[model samples]
Target: MKKLTTALSLVAVMAISTQAATLEERVKALEEQNTVLTEEVLASQSAGFTLVDSEKTFNGMGPAASKVYFSDNPLSIGGYGEMFYANPDNGDDFADVYRFITYFGYKFNDWVVLNAEIEFEHGANADKGGEVVVEFLYLDFLLSNEFSLRAGHVLVPMGLINLRHEPTLFNTVQRPEIERQLIPSTWHENGVLAYGRFDDLGIEYTAGIVNALNVNNSKTTTPKTGWIRSGRLGSSKNASFEPAFVGRVDYTGVNGLIMGASAYYGEGSNLKNDDANDVDGLTTAMFDIHARYENGPLAAYGLYTQTTLDGAEKLSSNAAEKASGYYGNISYDLGGLLGVEYKMPVFAQYENYNPVEKTVDGQNEDAFETETVTIGFNFFPTKQTVIKVDYEMNDVNSQETNTLSVGLGFIF
Candidate 1:
């Protein structure tokens, strides 16, 4: 009977031990769940996102990642830069590695924006003499989708590329000649611009005073090669005016296209030391029209610009002479022609221009005309990076020249 009692005692002890083990496991699991919940709470608090107990859904993060964030108002940041190598193949052997352009910009509230573009030709050093320019420093006020005002350094909106020529944004190695010569690509001066979008008519008008022409013969004169030096300065005849009025108009959102016209007219900005010499004064006007079509993977664009000058004493004196120039450019894109997708974007583009038309002082020889044609393909591994290969033929009214360019262009 004593042995039976001891056996019952052992059985009771086993039951109590099993129950204790099960209770300990349940407590451990509850503790682990609490730890996980604490960790999740901490993470959510630090990350600035709400912690939800339900399923997760994908959110729109594309714009945020791209630096194009949307708040009560939309804002975007974008810019591009390029480095290039050129072989003229003319036996003259001219090669340059340069920083094309760098731009930083901000857009605020739909009606106000800021943009600054800096250019480094060889490198960012003073001896190389790179230029620091304010491409556009202005405030834009939008009364409505149809009416707005822009004041500051306004671009001379006369060509197709001038308004949208980010290095990675364009397919060609360089801008077309017509845009470079006739319309003066990258042309901007101090002024206020008025623009609006009305239904199918996208209209733009600008009138502002700007530094007048520099007719200083000593400053603008160059050698007999007809390469008219750099076009950064104005004529000497109207040095005193220092400013002139400019304007433009554009039509957009029409059936499959966009078109525009522009005009610039102003008195000379320079002053003459000798009034009797008769500084005939200077006046310039540019007219242009453009059209483009883009849908899906295909795109095409074309434009023509003509520039004219009048009022000069003669080709030699601080007097302006009658000179005119014109150019045209067109480009078309063919979607990945070989099924290469991002590896290949075939394109064909052509440009021709006669930038300088005045005769050499005393020599009575006219400036040579410049024309360029480019055919190439682009490889875009991503939206921000591109590899370009192009063959260009640059012809002058006096000679023939060509260049082959292949390079990588990107933005970060």
Candidate 2:
């Protein structure tokens, strides 16, 4: 009986030992799996594309253009696109893929970065008034919070829309006409720029020397017709490279408010090579004051700009010596009032501009005078996408023309 009892006790001990071993093996396997899953989650987060932060901007650039500054990976890719349909009172109605732009960026290190923008306009079909072009390519050397350097093809930081031209940033179906005619929002040039910010003072500054505009190389009409708008020599192969000085300053001391001024001074003549025009010492000066404010459901923005040509009279009998314009826009979001998840903003805008506000020969000064009134609304299904509708009334030299437009825009 004693031997049998001892044998039973030994058997019970062996069973317990076996159970302990099994539990140890299972725990070890589970630990290994947990480690592997943690690694995969980390790798996936750091790889592929980073989602855009719509409210974030760096160095006064649009949100997508500023993606590189906040990327975790070395390579960052982002872009924006827009399409619209227009029906005019006296013109054929048409739909156009207005612009598609892509931004590519590489982080060489913490302090050095490279960024480029490639653009396709009008569907990129060369035969149908479409073309692909490089809008900007630049390298930034981030030295400190107070100062940094940017070199290469850079956007001219002269006006509000010139630096922030993304479709979602504005409220209208089209860009402000004043910005397009007087400020030339998409202006870019090859140059070096120095920029800095003072956080305590809420002041930001940019000063640079860029390729000057050659009045002799007007692509649209003669220099006399649209001198100010036509003088933008953006990344053109035949563009002359004369040095121009540009400076800008903004005050952001108040929350959700930005007010600033900018100026450009340059010689507009292409005397470096033998051009057909007999103009010399043609100096161009431009200046603008701009402001924008947003608080909860309300938003407003506007600008006043002027340009002067010193030697425009020598270029042509009808050349414009002065150009000036002003515009204002205000919008209120109904989403907040209605307690909806999506955003809906209704807006109104007014503009008065004359590309030929003053002529050298003092004739037909009012020929290009225009007054525009636009009423629009935008529906944002998502933070990165918007659908827009607007009606525009344009009075050109007292002739009224009206148009209706619908559009969609997106960024990523």
Candidate 3:
């Protein structure tokens, strides 16, 4: 809600600083702030939203999203940016500011908190066709580690990228296409969320009810045409009373490793299970499981997701029966293994997906099936910043294309 780039400029100084004393001073201030935050959070426990040392995120949420939960200071400002140069064999070469994002958090005492994300894409120029979007705005009422509540436009805990899309967290210059077209990263809706963790068993969970997707909009045939991404309400159209439920669970018993599975279920559009309406059991269901292992010099991760639409074929001309995709990556830190001065890891990723895996027979459709292989390396001048370069080979719906790119990403 606040255009605070200028304000961010003041805080940005700390990220770009090279002086040791400045870093030390910042750390000391951060520690003092934490001490105060803990005390206030504890004192406010009478309202049912306090936990000692609550600063730690039991669930795998991004650093920015979790900032307000335990901040002694009322406001927390941080951001990340990615700028890149891309050269495609089949297209022109260009350089662009791919993403500029800012995270703003405010703690209105311990029981209530506000978190938001403002995103600027492609340089944020109207002439150049750039745009800005309020990616997320949510409020959390912390009850305890075992139970808490969140409302407003909240992110769906469905895919890895949806929560941890910070560039440095992934290997390639771009996120996996499957996560984009299939799961639709950055997916959020008007809803309330319930999340908590059973720390004794290393189990974390979240359940929520949100506005259901508008798959049957008459103006756009996205639903009748079997397009999934366009169905997201996104706070644009009047959110239909039809609601969806999401549930997720994560197991983090092993140190430096996490495994999770989640599901989404809802009525497809406004279609009901009424035979008189000629649409029965037209429900949409999605399931996914993912795992990540990052310990020592080796890293490995993978995700598999699939969706099914019951009675969809009878409701839409281009409805799909099933859609699925999966991706995996493995990397090892050769620099560390070789005792090099800097840390660099060579990584490779493979993705296979079909946006419309199985559509209604006899209906015309674009499968949007694709496979990709990417090889890249990341160099860290500091723990918070990374320089990345990679080559991607795309098997686009059976066609071949190649691209090479280099970029920088930093978090503070």
- Candidate 2, residues 206-243, lDDT tens digits: the string is 99999887665442124343566677777878667889
Q: Which candidate is the best by TM-score?
A: 2
Q: Lowest summed-lDDT stretch of 10 residues in model 1? A: 53-62
lDDT of 1 by residue, 94-167 (tens): 44545555444456766565555555655656676664555545566666666667665555455566666555
Q: Which ten residues in a row have the lowest lDDT in candidate 3?
A: 46-55
* Shift of residue 203 alpha carbon in model 1, Å: 4.1
The lDDT, on a scale of 0 to 1, for candidate 2 is 0.88
The parts of candidate 1 lying over 4 Å away from their true place are 1-77, 92-97, 100-102, 106-110, 200-208, 215-241, 271-280, 295-298, 314-336, 358-367
Each prediction's RMSD over C-alphas, in Å, is 15.0, 10.3, 14.2
What order do you get sorting by lDDT, best first?
2, 3, 1
Instruction: Indicate which candidate wins on lDDT.
Output: 2
Ranking by TM-score: 2, 3, 1
**CA lDDT of each prediction against the hidden true structure:** 0.54, 0.88, 0.77
Compute the lDDT for candidate 3: 0.77
TM-score of each: 0.68, 0.87, 0.80
| Model 1 per-residue lDDT at 257 | 57
Candidate 3 accuracy as TM-score: 0.80
